[model samples]
Target: MRKVCCIFIFCFSTYTTFAQNVASVNGKSISSKEFMWVYKKNHAGVTSASQQELADYLELYINFKLKVIDARANNLDADTAYKKEISGYESALKAQKKTSPKNIEYNFIMNEYREGVLMFNVSEKKIWSKVHDNEEKLLEFYNKNINQYNGNDFSDARGRVIGDYQQYLENEWIKTLRAKYTVKVNDDELKKLAKL
Candidate 1:
């Protein structure tokens, strides 16, 4: 009986080792062992990660890969504006990498402008563009989102609501603009990655 039990245990261990089908992209197979290794390479030693958290992160990696694939398919990679933006981002990252972490704050504040002129520029261009001073629009904005600007009257939250309403308007506008884009994720690859 003990010999039979040992044989059963050996067979089960072998089967379990062979059962893992790890690597896949959009339903295509990849090396399971390599996939697990890459997932661990990215995620191991993270203090906050549990087994489930590690699995979730692997799924995120797979989703990122899918998005990259779709982006390439749509010719977004060849877009001049995208190229410029990506190049600028990579250059900024490289520049940051050159500086020691201890000196990072100083570099970010002065050289990178932590919250200086560029913040103002972004606010003026992206955020402030949505704001308007017309009394009719203000009244309309207040009426549509009165709960947010709720108070005794316009006098109580005039300044607050104006900024809040403008931010809200910009957020909605961005969401609407995003509808022009299409996106999809591969659930199968994500699930397989999660196991790793």
Candidate 2:
């Protein structure tokens, strides 16, 4: 009876640990904790998680992992883009480890390059063109969301009003740009990944 109880306990522990390791890509396990962190970071304000959402995200992440592995196998990791991404992530990790001003500066530069350059280029080319506004479109947007403009005098929220207007314009531009790109995710693959 004692041996049987011990086996049961061991089985339970193993199962619990295995469940916590969500997926293994190229022998690298992505822990449930890591997955949760990524999920929360991407969905800051969301209150609920749908199964489909989980599946889709998991699939996308696994595909990305596979791509990274492939890239390394093909020696693409030595390329500038791969190196930049790795360096940025490495710098961020190092900054967290040593909290030094120099490390902080390194992180800032890495973040700036990623957010300002790479992200800006991708977003501008894909999303900006869609939302690009001519006078007609701007006027149309203003007309549609007139309630936003009808509030108390602009003097009070002048900065906010202008920022909103600019963002609206940029959003339209991005919408236009995204129309040119072909982007699709496999639902079946996503669902399968969620089970992993």
Candidate 3:
């Protein structure tokens, strides 16, 4: 009975430690294993990373989570456009899974696509939507940067101008986003990653 109790306590403690949270935003926990999985996958091609490099990557990951949180708060995750896009992606992933159940490459591709969609939805809400809705500003941007446009008429050049304007807006918005989120890294977890 004593041995059984000791084993139970050990198992419970191990499970709790294994499921430890690496970071939290607001009140939501991000698991350490999940963070390490993503970090390792993303940096798999690299031979090694320093503690500083891992820390910098953690900041980027935290910022990504903050943006996702902001998107959820703003109901962007529930938006019809986002829903439709994600639904389409789910269907594609389902088909891929059916075709190749054990394909790591497919799994990585799907993960990349999902992250891309999330980033796209956030950018659409934060930057692209504003640039697209404000025709006057786009026109003004076109006029000021007219020399950069190579077209016979405004109609011909409008698409290029809008694309450039979207990029400009995205850059400015990223700067603001970096300032908006307070990021904290778990130094111990980061050191572990550095050792790996």
Question: Whose lDDT is greatest here?
Answer: 3
Residue by residue across 1-196, what tens digits does model 3's lDDT show? 9999999999999556544755665555656655666777788767468889877777677767766766766777677877788778868877756645366555555555655667768877887778866889988988888889765466788878888998888667656665675544456666766777
- Per-residue lDDT of 86 in model 2: 59
Model 3 root mean square deviation, Cα atoms: 7.3
TM-score: which candidate is best? Answer: 3
Model 1: per-residue Cα lDDT at residue 121: 38
Model 3 TM-score, 2 decimals: 0.58
Candidate 1 global TM-score: 0.36
Would you estimate the TM-scores of all the predictions?
0.36, 0.39, 0.58
Distance from true location, Cα of 9 in model 2, Å: 7.5
lDDT of 2 at 127: 38
Model 3 local distance difference test score: 0.71
Off by over 4 Å in 2: 1-14, 45-47, 78-85, 88-196
lDDT by candidate, in order shown: 0.53, 0.55, 0.71
Cα deviation at 33, candidate 1, in Å, is 18
| lDDT against true structure, model 2 | 0.55
